[model samples]
Target: MTQKSPVESLIQLSAFDPVSREDPHARMKPLREQCPVWRDETAKTWVVSRYADVRAIVSDNTLWRNGINAEEGSFARLLVNQEKLDLPPGERQSILTMDDPDHARIRTPLAKALYARVAKARPKIDAIVKETLDGVAGKKSFDLIEDVAIPIPIITIARILGVDDARLGEFRHWSEGAILALNPVRTPAETAHMEASNAALDAYFTELMAERRAKPQDDLVSDMVALQAAGAPLSDIELKINLLALLIGGNLTTTDLIGNGVRLLLLHPAEREKLAANAALAPQAVEEILRYEGPVDITGRVLSGERELGGCPMHKGQSVMVVLRSANRDPDIFERPDAFDITRKAVPHMSFGGGTHICIGAPLARMEGIAFFSVFFQRFPTLKLVDEAPQWRTLPFFRGLERLMVEV
Candidate 1:
């Protein structure tokens, strides 16, 4: 057996690697320190790891999400290709995979409607969280991911989308399967499941859209229908595609936020005690958790024109993978970056990416997190982890646990 060079080892490092997946900071710290803008020849992409570099790349408007210069087989190209597969020919891509003009056209109305929905849904979100916790009240132990984390967001988003309680389970199933679309290297079975879920969602939403068109209800679907009827510049296809995006985005990532926050609090009892002592600390603790262990891992961009980043000269049409988790832990920006301190002053984290393409669902995710944590510890004062070792999911570009078992 031959020992690989340091650069080779770093090049081989991937989110899918079990060791790296479980503890990416260990692998990423070396990469950030040694080569902040390292190019992975195998993936034909530049990997930006340092906080400053990632911020610069994301903040630059010249960088494109439409994959104009993205190398073949690169993560950017994979995302673009997947979007192509999901949409019909000649249709605009979802805001997640498109540049401005089209991206803004679709995003503005959706963002407006979503913000309004989330703003008014706070009380409902709290009620949902309390009701969800109430569901597991008598149980001595339960999987936090399934019992608490999963239901709150799913139920909330379902109601927002006009999906009734009767179909919450089906809505959840589609969301779980459809989220596989984010995994660039999904298996054939996973791919099939994703497609099936997409198909089911398409059919369901199509019917619902027609119904909403005929009779507008007081929900997101109806809100969108009203927006379109009032000439909001969104087409039917874009509306459906983005609705699907909101559904998947709103559920899984928020689920992980709750799950990861609980795990973090459990692991750091002192921090938990502080939060338990002061409910006002819940919002700050949520931010700390987002910084320390965010759900999404990497967001990338394709250079629209030739540009230099992190002292590295890059060409037109080249892709740059911004490691958000790595940036969150960059020592240059974060003091004691590796330590989990819930009371740390709120520093903006790259967990929700940055700039124009920042995750639009972020406010709502934060709301869900604050709502969950505000009452969770108070309700289950005796909560503790069943397993200290977390079982992280293997899905690339996503950092979430497969399960978080706990005793209350």
Candidate 2:
């Protein structure tokens, strides 16, 4: 086997290199073609980039969700060793991190709550999208990340959980901190902020739970609390953990996904025009956007036992990084994969993932995407980027614009 290049070795360590963040597709394309299951030497883990390999690994239920210590170098060791002090790394993971029966026991009820809330929120989601846009009505230039993308999902999720609207700004701050906490290289200040955010979150949710129990509204939290009282009750810890998951998942992923879509639309005028002309294509465009440049690039999984993926030896307990973004663009799976086409016959993409751990919020995300693009085009027909080159954030796990300066 050939010796790995410096870049490949650096990737292993999960360093936040500017080149990859600015244009990872350029760097990843050649690597994925040459090595489907390549290990990052510095990061000490395997990264699978091909569509077939990534899909197979993700589909296999035997794999455990693994490898949360994202900070690079010795700082990572500090986090792992001090695991007792860590917040529960919540996603779909809060309840389903364990194997089999236990996983199902915890997840079943939570999934029910999520599905019910999504159905109830559909009619009003469109209005929420318009209301967000209205906040910046007549503005010449605005930061899409701050003014629009972040607020929409946070407020929607907050409202669904019956969280106080007055605390919207606080929710945004803590959510951003929690999301940034996913990064390994957080400085002392960032780490402090993250810890404070988690502490505040615990306290806030604790109060909300008390309030819900007292008032007993028809919101999701109230519903869950009521269910517990009648017969099946989620534990206090479980409830708090699940609330964190819903808030973060509901807000962060959709925010980045929406930002990515708007950024792509601006870059590719031809595709944007096609969507503007036919609003019905908004849903397809969202899928294409997800395939072409989804917000989340990769996620980690632990091998349950010795298995060979793409002919590479994957041992039990070894970490595997499923490169969803790279897999979506694999030339083998997608012809002319680089091109963004809304009307192309549906090609299955792993944007929401697959199998047991598939995203639970996919329905809500789709609604938000369609609503945002539909109204975005209609509201700001002549919107154009003030700075054609968007300042993309240097986040390895998350992909999004730091700021989208647009003139309406």
Candidate 3:
């Protein structure tokens, strides 16, 4: 039998394929085994699988650079709502796209504030979850995402940001547009949606900041406004973009996490029963869910210098796609990598990423996940997945569904 070259193996590999997105482990296992750092000739990108290589590459800032195309590469792509700005040539990028001191500069101002807010969000999270669940009480059937998963993150984050509930309709519409901006293979309609959303986001945040400055509510925007007022170096655009990034970044993936966790739980009945029996296991269940079906399937970086990864030489200016989802299921690191066992001990996963660019919203996401599942399972103990073959959004970069139909 003849073996294909690394590039040849990846020549036909397209991450956007529906089959591959539905079953990423099956698709990635071969590449992870034979070509952990395969190059794609047509796309001119390197693909990194395996836990060790992925962690090493993302952690090493000197070897790789972010901030190129914010939508396609870096953590920026995970949760984004962007507009093509005509700013001065040296205008700064969002913190998601930034590397080193630049990224740290923006993150430092709000990092502590973000942690504090999420830490204090428990009572709020519980209230929101109960309220959200209460809304669907009479319905025997409902879309998990629309009725359950989506609202928890959006409403919770909105409350955290002091967004008026009346504006949520507009906010949800704008957010839909923003998510499309992250699609690498968006259609003309999707492009239009993204642009429209970007404009709305800018206007909405501008107005929000103005209002916060006048009234100073007990919320995230106010916290940021306070920091800005206190001479913590922040530009108007920086403040707006950073806050928007936080909003979208926190909501997008967390929504996916909840929906995915529900799907995984339904698919594995024994595990679901175990989680239902003991609510305390919800935290570990969240970890297992993340490992099995994470929100962000892939993140990327651009090579800054000639680097060797997985014994393959890659030159500067090239791009690398790091499959965080793939690394989580490394057979070497996991006893039964493919199994969805909620009781599985936590052994770290790349769903939240690593290094300096690690997700600032990790704690909030975890807390949300634990709260969401614990309440959701308890609320609908006999909830049935109405559509076993539920539809999925065939997004290459993001893993989520259009709807998760469930019978309460």
Candidate 4:
């Protein structure tokens, strides 16, 4: 019998594979221990698995997100799509796909506006959570994903963005479709759904912007419009695209965070009791949930210059796939990493990517998690998981349940 090489072994653990998707840690454990860094010739990329290695790669600014220097047909180039170079700057990329000057230019104003909005949004967030839970009250059995996790973030973010309650159903549908952007491998139907959502968002924002200009209101959309009018360095298209990005980013991940956190609490009744006994533990529990099963599993970077990582020689234009989940679970970083302990004091998790490109909406997501968990168990003390073996979504680079059925 022939033994599979490390590269072959790594390649087989494709994110699209069901077995890998269901329990990636089982496949990642061996690689993290033995082959921390291995170049997959098939994908023409370097896969980094260990905690230290993943941290170094993400923190290094030398590796860029834009893939401007990437070689043709390489993973980096494929990510940015060099073919779109001729398009307008705003038309070509979102803040996630930009580097340095362009990234800062757009990120600055957006972050200022978003952080300001989120800082004052605590009251609104609590109200939204209460309202959502109110809807699920009196139900004997319901899907945590559909009934609770999904609605809270969508409503909270929509309110933040100045979107009206009347159009919330549409916003939810568009967000569901737009989240397909996170999936690298998409079927034809998925691609179409994403495109349609993008188009709808563009049109809606365009009209909304015009309205805000005509009569500015006291919401995020109006604040952004005022900033642009005050000479912020943002194009119309850039503003629209980033707003769409925020809409999706603000909700989808938070939804998963709530779902995953609740599931963890259900799976470990002792932990739930601990949290219920002391609401102060909610914040720590949220961090543990992020470390254990974050919504995002992987993030990538393209090398701008030749460099070596974890004893492996890498070249300019090569891509590095950072396995965030693996890094969070590395035994070297967290004691008994696989075990979920809200009280554990350890290094910060890589669920939110590090460095310049760290998630801007992380605070908002964290707030939502804390708010949801603090109230959820208290509201439904008898809540219990109806399905022990809940199904996880097959989308690569993301970790979320398709449905978390529960009874109250």
Candidate 5:
């Protein structure tokens, strides 16, 4: 087997060009076909793109979600160690990243919480959505990320956690800082912000846990504390870790999903027009948005042993970055994968992911997507982009628009 030239860059691409913002599908398509599992020597890791290869790794227990194992590779290691995270990672704290029995124990309670109480919060979610949109309603032009996406998820998640409105901005700040620290281009200043944010939020959650123990309420915090007292428990560390994951992972990603989807519709006016003409097709349109432009472009896994992915051999402890962007556009899975068509009847896109560690917040994300898109179409039938292109976030791991100037 001929060894290909070593991959020199991890995500080596032009930065800050709004043209790339309009579409990333073209950029990821070829890699999915030609190099299903390619290694980046610069990053010192294997990157998988094709649908089959990506799905196998996600489903198979051989590959693990522990980011700590990826430390051996140069670029695979996240700058910040979430293991040292001060706040509980929240939903991400559960067994999603774990292998078996431990994962099952932690996931059981959270899964029940999500399917039951979280589902009931939809009415409250709808109200939050309306209030959020109302804040920017009638404005001639507004930045969608700041004006809409950020506030909605932050408010929604905060309410579920029983976090006070007064502390909402503080939560947003810490969450954003933690998320931003994972970016490939993180600076010293950004690192400082993340540490400070993490420390502050960690202390706050610890106090909240204490308060919940003293006087339990109907909120998730109280539920978790009650579980601990009853001995069906998650450790304080695990609780904090999972809580942070739930809050940051849940809150941040959806913000990007909605923000990116909104940008996509505006960029492709014909698609926007098509959706507007038939309101019932909005759900299908959201699916297309997820497939065409997913919020998370990539996720990493560490190899457990010598294994072959897409015909490439892997050794133990090597990192594999599954490019979700490429998998969604794999030609073998979806015909005309690059084309964003709302009516592409029931395509099984891996945007929410597949297998054991699939996103637990998927149902909630979908509900949020449906609610926002439905209301968006009804409210701003003529919502238009401020320009032909919009400013996208420079953060490499996550894909989203930093700001989209929209005119209602």
Candidate 6:
């Protein structure tokens, strides 16, 4: 047996390992320095890390496609649906996975509806943030991720989607299942867990769509059903899949965003104080948290045809995982890419991704972030982390803490 060189060892590291998941920056630093477009032979997928390369990879669809759409796929597959399992019969593809005309059809109206929700959600979101923050108040310690971060957006999105408030807990469980299913590598137990959760989510959203069509409500599901009834290019399956997407995508990322912000603020006490003194800097702090360490670690596109990207040749049907976390830290774009500075006047990172598939819940998430951070600090000015080293989950596509315990 031959000993692998250090560079070879780093290059061969598994994306789902504890080391990569815990500190991906360290595993990816040498790659960014030596192989900006690193290819994993075992996975047969290219990993692009540099900022320029990630951006180019996102827009150059002529060289890459979205979603691994298969004949055995469903009418309600997510934008990054790579699951192979039992699904209902219907022709479906999410706007996140589609290109051009197909994507435009669903995205245009969806954007309109989402923006309306955001426009009216500011006051309500503030209330939700305050209510969630209140739960952690007058307490010596609490799990920030569970008590504060998760509930804010989960409750907000539940209200927006018209799901019974009692089911908010169920939403988190299902969303976790949905996200865990996205892990490229899953154990047999995880597979069963995902299947069960997927079945429940699909049924729940479909039933909600039915109820909305029969009796229109002021909620988002009702609005989407109305659009579909009015001959919008959306089908019932598309509507349902997007609803699941919104529920999981909207709440999960925002939860991590809050967690990331709180963790960073706690780690950097001075910067936390800066935001505490000035409420207006909450938004900037949130943005910095996103750039420094976003929730989504990686996203990819399917190659459309042979083309040159990031000075590398690629063929059709190949996929490239653009590591957004790494891209955000590129020295070329950010002044001190690694530093977590609330006052940094930096260009936006690929936190919400790029191109047509940018995250739809960005505005709501921002509103939630600003409100949560501003209110949280105001309530607990001297909040501190209960545990300095919180464990992080090893999800291939997401970056978030398992538990962030803090105290006042």
The per-model lDDT (C-alpha) reads: 0.83, 0.75, 0.78, 0.83, 0.74, 0.74
lDDT of 6 at 348: 75
Inter-residue clash pairs, candidate 4: none
Note the residue pairs that clash in candidate 3: none
Candidate 3 residue-wise lDDT at 226: 89
Candidate 1's C-alpha runs over 4 A off are: 1-13, 82-92, 184-189
Candidate 1: tens digits of C-alpha lDDT, residues 169-274: 8988888788887777789999999999999998989988999999888889999999889999877777888888887776789988999899999989999999
Q: Candidate 2 on 270-301: residue-level lDDT in tens?
A: 88888888889888988998898887777666
Per-residue error at 160 for model 2, in Å? Answer: 1.2
TM, every model: 0.93, 0.90, 0.90, 0.94, 0.88, 0.87
In terms of lDDT, the poorest run of 10 residues in model 3 is 1-10
Give the poorly placed runs of model 3, Cα more than 4 Å off.
Answer: 1-15, 67-92, 185-189
Prediction 1 TM-score vs. true: 0.93
Runs of candidate 5 with Cα error greater than 4 angstroms are 1-8, 13-23, 77-102, 187-189, 277-279
TM-score, cand. 4 vs. native: 0.94
**Per-model RMSD to reference:** 3.0, 3.4, 3.5, 2.5, 3.4, 4.3
Question: Ten-residue segment with the worst summed lDDT in candidate 5?
Answer: 12-21
> To one decimal, what is the Cα RMSD in angstroms of model 6 from the true structure?
4.3
| Model 4 agreement with the true structure over 58-89: per-residue lDDT tens digits | 88876788865666666666657567789865
- Report how far residue 224 has shifted in candidate 1, in Å: 1.0
Q: How many pairs of residues collide in each model?
A: 1, 7, 0, 0, 18, 3
lDDT of 5 by residue, 1-408 (tens): 134533235564222333334455545555555566788877887877778887887777667666555655545455335655574343334454565556666777766666665778888888989999999897998988988998888777778888877888898888777665446567889988887977787787898999999998778888887877888667776777777767667776888889988888877778878777776777888889888877877766778778876567788878887877778888888899768788889878788776667888888887788778877867888788887566677766567777888888
**Model 3 quality (TM-score):** 0.90
